[model samples]
Target: MEMRKEKAALSSQQGLNHSPFHTQEHMRRVPPKEPQVTCRSNTYPKGFYCSWHLQHPTYIPTDFEVYVQHNQRPLEVTRDEVHKNRCHVKFPELFSSFPYRVNVTAVNSLGRASIVFLLVVHYHLHRGLFGPTVKPDPPEKVVAKPVANNARRLEVTWNSPSTWPDVETFPLKYFLRYRPLIRDQWQHVELSDSISHTITDAYAGKEYIIQLAAKDMEIGTWSDWSVAVHSTPWMEEPKPITSTTESDIIPETTPGPPSAAPRVGEPTAACSTLLWSTHLLLACVLLSIM
Candidate 1:
């Protein structure tokens, strides 16, 4: 089992190498978009972090930089453990202030596009232009499954993002969106401080795509939507029909009446009439003999 898992991982990693970025068609282009830096504190008063990403693969050795800006001192960025395009910066300071400037740029072999977010920023004004809180990371480990025996119900569940250190102290609310593959519109709902929800009105037997976003309860903007999870509502299985042979059949029978016996469920008068007819027949026989 472990060997099979290793082989599967290896196959996926190798597939990454087969991308067009690895080919020699074109290389070394200027960064397409400016970096839009988002720095926020999921755990307030303790510290805050900033993270940004390269829009697309560069095909060459690439690195990211996040600066303190005011002091021109470069803030060290650590690459995320899972996502290579993104990097992280941890700062002991905090903020909520007048909008600060952010510059984002992307250059790479996969150069389709890039963009910069020129919105609010700063280290220590005690509140963003919008509010005191900031958008938390999106929900994690999202799962969507069909409810058993319910063709129109879908159950979904997820966990708080790991970036939020104190879930018990500072709760998070969620927004869920889902749509079936056949439709373009999405159905959305707000789940207050809950990690699970049931979509009771899902189309029966239809496959659905679901995603979730999170924010600090009562404050802050919503995070980006989480990765999508797909599911299908339940459908009952058809029952098999069994065949019966002659041996399994019992033919119905009717016995001949003895002396005109009354049928079952008949009135008691039927039995009396049968007896009177017998007596009249006997009398007629005696007269003939005389």
Candidate 2:
């Protein structure tokens, strides 16, 4: 047993001296061959289920090893084998916003290939059909009420979203939505051209929350819900004016005091002239008779 162990150790030392590390293969340096890599999509989201298909070019051996390098360091990723010209690679985390290169190498039964492939991994923003891209800006102000002549009707008035330098022409279409405050249901009213609307079927004295959204026609996107405004119709009953109590009635038929006669000496100038005229007339008559 001792001789057998000694013989095995001697053979191992001889093989080690003839190996590539001890010969010119160790001293000689060769540039790592750049493998041929291709990408399917230019942009991809992080943490989602996505695959990157990669394969080396035509070579002696079709086997290859895959690796992901972040900042020039090998990432902790398990490479999957492929039967065809494709291999699926998954990313656990998104490192940067820009593109990151993926390195792929080929290996065969003889030995691992020195060739490597570099692929760009593009990162995309996390977004859905209706994601959180909606801006949190407040909504415009709106006022609504019933007309005087109509009892079961309402008229709504609105002003554009208050902004500095005053928006000359509002480019967005307004969406007016309202429903009973107490109920869970709602009603939507879409105004294509007009900002104000006249709605008649609303309940009397009921409060409602009117919502508004500004549609960006340029980008064809709708902004988030603006700040909500509350509205309630007037409920006070109309009262008529009437004099029902005695205190409210006006007084009539008041009595007047008696008046005294004029003084006897006040008219003497006019009365004496009239008496002298009458005496002259009587003397003329007596003379005529004599």
Clash tally, candidates in order: 15, 2
Q: For residue 175, what is the lDDT in candidate 2?
A: 74
Off by over 4 Å in 1: 1-66, 69-87, 91-133, 245-290
Q: Which TM-score value belongs to model 2? A: 0.35
Candidate 1: residue 7 lDDT (0-100): 100
Which regions of candidate 2 are displaced past 4 Å?
1-138, 162-170, 218-221, 233-237, 241-251, 255-290
lDDT of 1 by residue, 1-290 (tens): 99999999999888776767754434554435455466665654344455665554454554554334323334455666886555554442344443433334454544434344333443433332234436787899999988999999999999999988777866888999999999999999998889999999999888999999998775667988999999999999999887998899899889767777767877687778998999999999999999
At residue 72, give the lDDT of candidate 2: 70
TM-score of 1: 0.53
